[model samples]
Target: MIKLKELSRLYNINKTIVEYGLIELLPRQHRPFSYTLMRIVLFWVRTKHQHLSLPERLRLSLQSLGPIYIKLGQMLSTRRDLLPPIYADQLAYLQDNVPPFCGELAIKQIESSLGKTIDELFENFDATALASASIAQVHTATLREDNREVVIKVIRPEIEKTIQADIQLMKWLAQLMQRFLKDSERLRPVEVVYEYEKTIIDELDLMREGANAIQLRRNFLGSKLLYVPEIYSDYCTKNVLVMERIYGIPVSDIDALEAQGTDLKLLAERGVETFFTQVFRDSFFHADMHPGNVFVSYDHPEDPLWIGIDCGIVGTLNNEDKRYLAENFLAFFNRDYRQVAQLHIDSGWVPEDTPLEEFEFAIRAVCEPIFEKPLSEISFAAVLINLFNTARRYNMKVQPQLVLLQKTLLYIEGLGRQLYPQLDLWDTAKPFLEDWMKEQVSPTNLLKKLQQKAPFWLEKLPDLPELVYHNLASGKSLQKQQKQLIVSITKQQQKNSKSYFYIGIAATLTLVSTLAYLQTDKNLAMIAGIPGLFAWFLAWRHTNNE
Candidate 1:
């Protein structure tokens, strides 16, 4: 059953799709009969954006739908495997450029979340939003305790309900696609929607975002490559987050960056270095690296520092993934297509039965052309995209775990090239990967691992002798029990043999008695019968005695 509100929302969504001319974007042959009926039913909702390209209109329809749809578009942009390059390229321009909600409402929500009045919590609080995004908006304030400038982020009122409703609709639509589309399995529409749902839902919890920001800030505390803003924990809540305010030039402002004499080349290289360091050294990275969330610190123009904001979304890699990924990158750098193919099999990214030679040839075919140009002209993201596409033909499933990593890599590479066109990503990353690989097997790393486990080892050291003694005693006890069991079995077998012998004698006597009776010999019969009875009693007594 559908509520009136949801039905109304759906109708509006359909209207937007029609107005943006999204249905025409699909092939005429592919469009379902229902689509034509929809056009007739909603005849008033004609196509309004005839001037825009199909991709552009598609992007506009999603944006007009709301925050959830806009976020969906942003996520889909990273999925180059599923969408064409033109659609993906247009969707990449999707931004969280939502209109700000009421400032009074934001203040009330913050006060309600913090359980205090706005004046009681802070001084010089600004009602106007510092920034407005899809999930939340930021407001500037001065903390009463420390007099430090900070930004307070508040979740929009009833945003979660809207997100949940939209997600439900998305899931329903995904099911329709899976049921009707010929090759929907390849698209994995349901799984993609579920992924987007989780990501958007996670962004709703401001406390998780605060923790992520804190961890990231600590990881890059003294680093020149990146700077994470300090989160004010005491004032933070699930719906409201307070963090130190930062005034840095947005990374997209190329003119401003150049005007400030910022070292663009070093800045670009540092971006690559920062990504590798987070992925390899720390195993944690800011997954959302769009220009809106990235900025340049004004303090260091000669040695630029990146200021990261909106740490609501982050990606982490375990040791296994990190190691395999490092090896894969190194293999790609060396043009070792065989090793690359082997790593995919070893990592269980592809089926073990996938022919090694065929996979290697396919990868080489797609990737070899990428290296023909100078290293500076090559695109790391392009190489990865080609590799993934080639692997898909061998029945390789998409790795949901690596989705964020792939998206982040695309963002970093694009940002790097935008800052410095001739950036040699391979040259910048190869040495770092080599050093990291060396560190994995180094004696120092071994010592470090030992140190990490020393406390546990020490805690159990006192119990070792007692545990050894108990184990030996239990073993001897078990052996003794085994011997006793063997003797008992032997005795039981002897008793059974004696019982069988008596029973055989009893049977012979009974047969003799019967033969005598048949011969009409009373005396002989009586004698035999009495003996048979005695033999039967003896056998019974023997069996009972054991």
Candidate 2:
């Protein structure tokens, strides 16, 4: 029932559309009732009617729904193919910003989490937030002796309860959808909820995010590909995290980046290379590559370096997925749409019964025109969306793990476009994946396997002779045991036969003796017959027991 309210409330969302002037911008304008219906509903609760632009209404709606719906709006905004241009344009303006709880409340949260006063824990802490988001906010600080600048992040105390309540409502909606909605299973809404649950819950743990940052930092430790900030483990807790503060311009400031003399083209290409390195080489990547979370270093402005933040939503792929994905991308580059379609079926992304030839043609129809143009003109995210839609017709399944990877790719490409319009993503990323594939299947992997197996082989080496000898000894022992058991059963059967024969003989002798003594006593005949009958009954009883 609560689930119904949660879904119903979104449709009845007040204020946002009216405030932003989106009452006139409902999607189906060709149908005349669209605008009037939306306007009536949107203006329901306004004391003073206010006019807002299309984008403004979107931002207001996102803010009104709070974090969960804001996140959904953020995701939907990325889907350029799925949404109309006007709506997409407006949705792009949606922001995650919220009024932070309070400076004192944040202080209390940090102190309680660390079990120490702010001064004892840090030499200095800025009361004002450097940045704030849905679940947490960051504050700039410094150590007592080293005097190095660092950022401390703390989770809002009641944020978990709020998120949990929203999640429960989402789950309830998904369950209802499965029971009553057509094509709900096709979307796998329940599984999607569970995946969202895992992702958001994982983000609540600051230490886990700290470890994530550290591991991603290690992956590119000495490289210029991407820089993940160092995590200060000593200061990390479930609710609090302190990490190195970096200085770089936000990627959104194109004019500022240009003023710094950054080579926008090379920077765009490098971004693509960094993405490939993380996915193919490291198999772990910073999943949240949204524009707000990324920054460009001016130190080497001509050859700009990327500073990545927010390690909360990283993605990983298993070995099989990595291989198939690499192969699929390579095939797409070669314009072998047939190979691409086959790879999907072979990897179990599509059902086995999907006709290979038809699927291949469908893929070619969708991708051929896109790749015919330059890479910059090609949107990798759009291509993927098309493929997924086509595959859906053929009963394809979404690999939940790949969702983060896809999201990151879209962000990387979007950022790249903002930096340089001529960025060729396919050209930049192909070489790296090809090189990594060769290394994965190289002789070095075989040698590494042998090295790993050395200890087990050595342990068995000393017992080789004893094992062989035991096997030979046991072979004859089993045959001999079987023969002895068979012989014993045969002897038992012969004993039964001998006992019957003896009984028959005794009965015949008793009868003969009775005939010879018949003249002496008539009673002797009856006694002889009785002995015969007794022997026969005894023999019959013995046979029955057997």
Best by lDDT: 1
Runs of candidate 1 with Cα error greater than 4 angstroms are 1-13, 23-38, 49-59, 72-96, 172-195, 465-546
Pairs clashing within candidate 1 = none
Q: After superposition, how far is residue 349 of candidate 1 from its true place, in Å?
A: 1.0
TM-score of each: 0.78, 0.78
Tens digits of per-residue lDDT, candidate 1, 380-459, equal 76787777778778867667678889889888877787688888989999999999999999999999999999999999
Distance from true location, Cα of 41 in model 2, Å: 9.1
Error of 1 at 201 (Å): 1.6
Query: Candidate 2 lDDT, tens digit per residue, 183-280?
Result: 66556778888998899889899999999999999988878768888888988999999899999987767889988898889888888898888888
**CA error at residue 112 for candidate 1, angstroms:** 1.1
